[model samples]
Target: MQSFEIDKSDLLRIKNALEDNDAELQRVLLQYHTSEIAILFEKLQPDERERIINVLPTGEASEVIAEMDEEHHPAELLVNLTPEKRSEIVEELDYDDATDLLSQLDESDQQQILRDIDQEDASNIRALLNYDEDTAGGLMNTDLIKVNGKLNKNEALEEIIRQSEEMEEFYTLYAVNDDDILLGILSIKDIIKAKKEVTVLELVNKEFVYVKVDLDQEEVAKLISQYNLTSIPVVNDDMKLLGRITVDDIIDVMEEENTEDILKISGVSEDEELSGGWRNAVKSRLPWLVINLGTAFLAASVIRSYEDTAAKLPIISAYMIIIAGMGGNAATQALAVTVRRISLSDLTDRQAYITVVKEFLVGMTNGATNGVIVAAVANWYDSNPMLGLVMFLAMTGNLIIAGLTGATIPLILKRVGIDPAVASSIIITTFTDCIGFLLPLWLATKLLL
Candidate 1:
């Protein structure tokens, strides 16, 4: 086969055929230029889109539909088809993509489509759907190419030929026993290189890794990343072969994991899909804002507790905020770094202790530098040497404590079996503000007031 040479003329011709409802031209484009045919399908009016979809072979349509924007994908194509047509379309889609498309629709519609699909395919899709969409099983395809352990290379090649005739996406062939217990895996490259007389069991690599169906998708991605596997087999805890998770699914899983962590650290729920509607966006953000409001008052209440001390020395209010802000930034930087380390498993043995000590040292240096600057500026602005000196002393102490608190809070949270990442921001912020407020007010009352 030669590489496709698509040009503007090709696109236009396909568009013209779609518009004119010329079945012959549509057939030609569908046969030779799937990409061009897809573009034409996308350009058609709703009814025209339905006509094109109805006419195209499901496999070609599925491959073309998979190329669409996630938010505007096969769901868009499905809405125009009958339930039976939708099932046929889904049955031809790669497993992960099929699950994703059905998941986008209303619950009732999704169920209807699934109920009408082939029983085996529907079962696989349902199983994938049952797993959290962010896990290994959820991201795996059901199109595994498996063979009995007894097959010789010749027999295995024959099996693969017949299987590949119907299934084209497989990478590795899982060699399993009669009971479906996994024995090993053999890559297609190995199959091609081997003597045809050899048994698949002899060709299979028993040392190959597999993921359990229930494993977290992030862990699956980490394994794939660490080993650079193109596809990996997934199994039940009992070692029964399930299916293979592809590189493409791992990429999506990695993206979803990254998105989930980013959102969680921002105090948003993991399920708040960023592509959702306005109601969803607002709903996801408001709870965090409200919790922050209450937490803000906790920081504020620290100041209220010291109001008497502050009133006697108004200069403290002006400089205290700056001191507090400086401490907040240092703590936040430390917290973010530590949280990422824990998330990525970059913090190794006793490294958390090293991190704590380094951050405290950093805090001490940071606090002293900022305190001197704040004190000097305050002294010049207020002409009160005592107020300036108090600001200097308080900020330095607050910043050091901020560093100690920042590093330890997450470690402590992890020790207590909490999600250190999710709770880190609130803990770091509240600590810095409260401690910054109190330390400064204490220094002010003792020295300036």
Candidate 2:
């Protein structure tokens, strides 16, 4: 067995193999990093990689192939394969992974793969593929143990053992009625604790809850956490057990959702990558950047309107920069906190509004306190009383605005079904900048000049 971590030279060798049309050597040469292997598959046109993928083991091979970024259509190669080969890959994939790949393929391609797969696999994939990618159904594993309530303790254990052989270590067993509605759940520990003589129907807990297939993954995660469930069953309209959302998968969903929100708060889109192509990356960000620019100009225009005040007291212009920075930073902090809360829980408009008022007060009191400190710092440097006063007023104003803007934007976005994080940076910064610049000049005009 040969395995080695690839370095620069290995990467070059893999590249050379693709150049030489050595698909055999290419597959063998590039088994080190799954992501890197995906990237290697990108070097050849899809037809070449498609040919290479055919020779590999189904599971590990499928993982490496799945590692390819969806942006690259080296998958076009996958689309051209025989329906049998396409399905061979699809059938071997886990429900979630298969759904991800299948959703990316064209309608006709998906149809062909579905037609070519086993009926059971096809049904499971279709059931999952039908749901939104963010929902529990899409993210959950359909291969879950479900026991009929009529089963006695011995019968249930036997059924669970048979299912375990099929799916392996299924921690949660859903107890369903004849109508297929979820009644409760049984854990592995619960099964083991039962007397061999006790009926499973008597042993299984009936208080456990479940979620619908269409429920958001975030919500599903909350349900699991709140109830302390190892796994939560997902059901369809008929209450037939469609799947179970496992904690491991829920953890992934939570990380993704939180990361997406964090990026959004920073005025970055989910697609912005540190290593993406310059053109693609810039295009993804440029629209929002341009929007941010427009708002910046709006801020500058406010400063422009008070240019005469700044002209009369050049100190106002100098201190305005500090104001803008303080406000923007404060607003970002508030926005991040609120956005994360909304993401994890059901935050009502009223609750958000109340939070806004509290943040405003918090922002104001803290801003005023920081303003006093900044004013003192500025006055210490310049030996001017008015400079200190200007710093204090501007800092207080900006902090107040930052807290309100940061908290409100995401909440509003949620209400509208837009990602709260989208354009959050641009919105919060624009508000803070506009306020930061204008407030100091306006205060200066009234008090200093």
Candidate 3:
């Protein structure tokens, strides 16, 4: 197979062909895989994408839609197709994928699409849709191979063969009792090696990791990554098997959770779409900026209080910015590390204490090193050793404060049930800015004045 990049030229060629209704060019698109075709959808206009989707085979079109980004509104493309074509594509989608697409549409649209699918698939999709989209149940797929533990090895093998024929892949076969309660998981290797007369109960491994339906998807991904599992089973309150969440779904959850954290850390709303209109971007960002402005006023007030001292020694104005900027940078360093640690797991009292102490020491050491360098530069610039000494002391004090506050704020927020990522940055900025400006000005007032 050959690979080709879908560049502007290729998009232009496809666009021109579609505009002209070029039959030969349309046939060439059929040769590309569904994933490649999906990429083309992103570059093409909505009408062109709809035309191509309508022209493709139903199964291929369904796969192409599935391959597109959920945020791109792939469900809208399905709406453009005729009812018969829409029904065919919807029927071909995996239950989880179909449910995800439908959930993105309006309630009436969701119901209309659901009515087109088979009764059994519709019921399964409805059941999945009932769970929170960030929970284990929502991430799981109903397509899995299961066998009764009471069955003989040959019977189990036959059942597995029958069940997996429609599935693209299977990693492990789940063994359940008559009540459909999950008993154990059997690896494919073990099943293949079992004697013909052996029972599945004899071969199944009872020690297996699984998640409850309500478990958060982040925790689900953590469990899968921690245990090195390709797929983890989902169970109800009674321990009845519901479905399996594969590694692919876990990857998606990881990406989403990471994106949300990054946005929150920057004081931006996670719900803000990257490709959304400027209006939405402003709406999502304005509140945080307002809070930041208020904090800026507070920092400015600190400077206003020291105006007499600044006016007396005008050179102090220049040094004030240097000290405050360095302090803010140091605090941000500590904040980043602390936020990541909190995300990994809940810290014990001992761990939290250790974290604070470590950051404090780091702050002290780094502050001393940087303060000495800046102190030397100040003395050289102003030819005043006393001025150097004052800067050194002020920088050292501000950095220690920075380190302490940065390390503690996020942990404190976590304790109070607040999302550390959301508010920690603003609070740390205020602490660093106020202290950063106040220390040098106050010191210069007493020493240099």
Candidate 4:
């Protein structure tokens, strides 16, 4: 297969073909993969994208739709196609993909799309649609290869071939009992290596990892990663296997979750949907800015209380900003690590305490090192050792405050049923800033005034 890169030149050729209704349009498009075509869709008008989907083979069109960034509203693009084309493309989609696409559409459109597909597909899509998009049920695909544990190796091999014919790929072969309860997972290698007389029950890995349908998708991803699994089975409360979540879907989930966490850490609302228009962008950000502004005043008030000292020692103004700024930066570093750790696993009370202590130690060592350096600079500049001493004490104190609050606030928020990633930054900043200012000024007042 030839490699291709979509660039300005490719975009220009595609656009000219689109504009002129050129005969070579389909031929030109066929050379690129659906994923590449989806990237092109981001630059084209919606009508042009709809036309491309209409012209492409149903299977390819479905992949294009699936591959389109969620920001482009692939659901809306499908709805724009003629009803027949829409139904055909949707029918070509897998149950999980179809469910995700339909869930993005309005209720009436979703129902219409669901109604248009085959009954079995519609039923599976509907079941998946009922799940919250953040859960295992929402992320799982009904398409999986399975065999009864009682089946002999030959029988299981036959069943696998029959079941896998339509699937693009499969990882593990799930073994189930007569009740459809997931007994365990079996490797395809184990099945192929087994003697013809051996039952699947004998080959099943009964200790395999699986998740309940209602489990959080992030937790599901962690399980797959920790166990080094390519796919994982999703079961109901009774342990009946409903579906499997593939590694591909987990990759998408991880990207989305990481993006959300990054935004939240920067004090943006997760609901902002970064894909939307200016109105949404402003609406998402304004409230947070206002809250940040409020915190700014609190920090300013600390400085106001020290106006007399600052006015007498004008040099202090320049260094005050550095002290507070360093404290905020240190707190942010701690916040990022703690938030990442929290996201990866549920920390035990002991682990949480250890994390706090570790951050405190880190803050102390870093603060002392940086503080001494700044102190040396201060002493050299003014030929006054007292100024240097005040700076060293203040930096060390503020950093300790930064480290403690950075570690503890997130854990406290998690215990209170709040998202640690969202609120921790703001709280940590307030603590660091107030102390960062207060500590240096108090030291100056007591030691130098």
Off by over 4 Å in 4: 1-6, 20-23
Model 2: lDDT of residue 20? 63
lDDT of 4 by residue, 1-449 (tens): 65556699989988877766535778788988899999888789888998788778889999999998888899999888888898888878888998899999999999987787788888888989999999999999999998999999999999999998889889899999999999999899999898999999999988988899999999999998898889999999999999999999999999999999999999988878766889989999999889989999999999999999988888888888899999999999999999999999989999999999999999999999989988999999988799999999889888888888889999999999999999999999999989988988888989989
- Report the error of model 2 at residue 289, Å: 2.6
lDDT of 2: 0.77
Better of 3 and 4 by lDDT: 4
lDDT of each: 0.79, 0.77, 0.89, 0.90
Poorest lDDT segment (10 consecutive residues) of candidate 1 = 35-44
- Model 3 lDDT tens row, 205-323: 99999999999998898899999999999999999999999998888888888898899989899989876789989999999999999999999999999989888888888888888
Per residue, candidate 1 scores C-alpha lDDT tens digits across 1-449 of 76555567765666566666557655655665555455555445567666767767777767666655454355866866887778778888888888878777788887888878898888888877877776777778878788888988778888888878767667788999999999998887887898877888888899998999988877888899989999999899899988788888777767766777678777887766555778888888888888888888999998898889978877678777888888888887887777777766646558988989998999899889988898898889888788778888888888898888878888888878998778887877888888878888887778866
Report the alpha-carbon TM-score of model 3 versus the true structure: 0.95
The collision pairs in model 1 are none
Model 2 TM-score is 0.83
Most lDDT-accurate candidate: 4
In order of appearance, the predictions have TM-scores of 0.82, 0.83, 0.95, 0.96
Error of 4 at 94 (Å): 1.2
Stretches off by above 4 angstroms in model 3 are: 1-6, 20-26
Candidate 3, run of 10 with poorest lDDT? 19-28
C-alpha lDDT (0 to 100) for residue 218 of candidate 4:
95
The local lDDT score (0 to 100) that residue 43 gets in candidate 4 is: 84
Error of 1 at 252 (Å): 1.1
Q: Write the per-residue lDDT of candidate 2 for residues 238-350, one digit (tens) a residue.
A: 77877887787777777777777776776667877645688877877788788877887898799779878878888777778988988988998888788778877768768
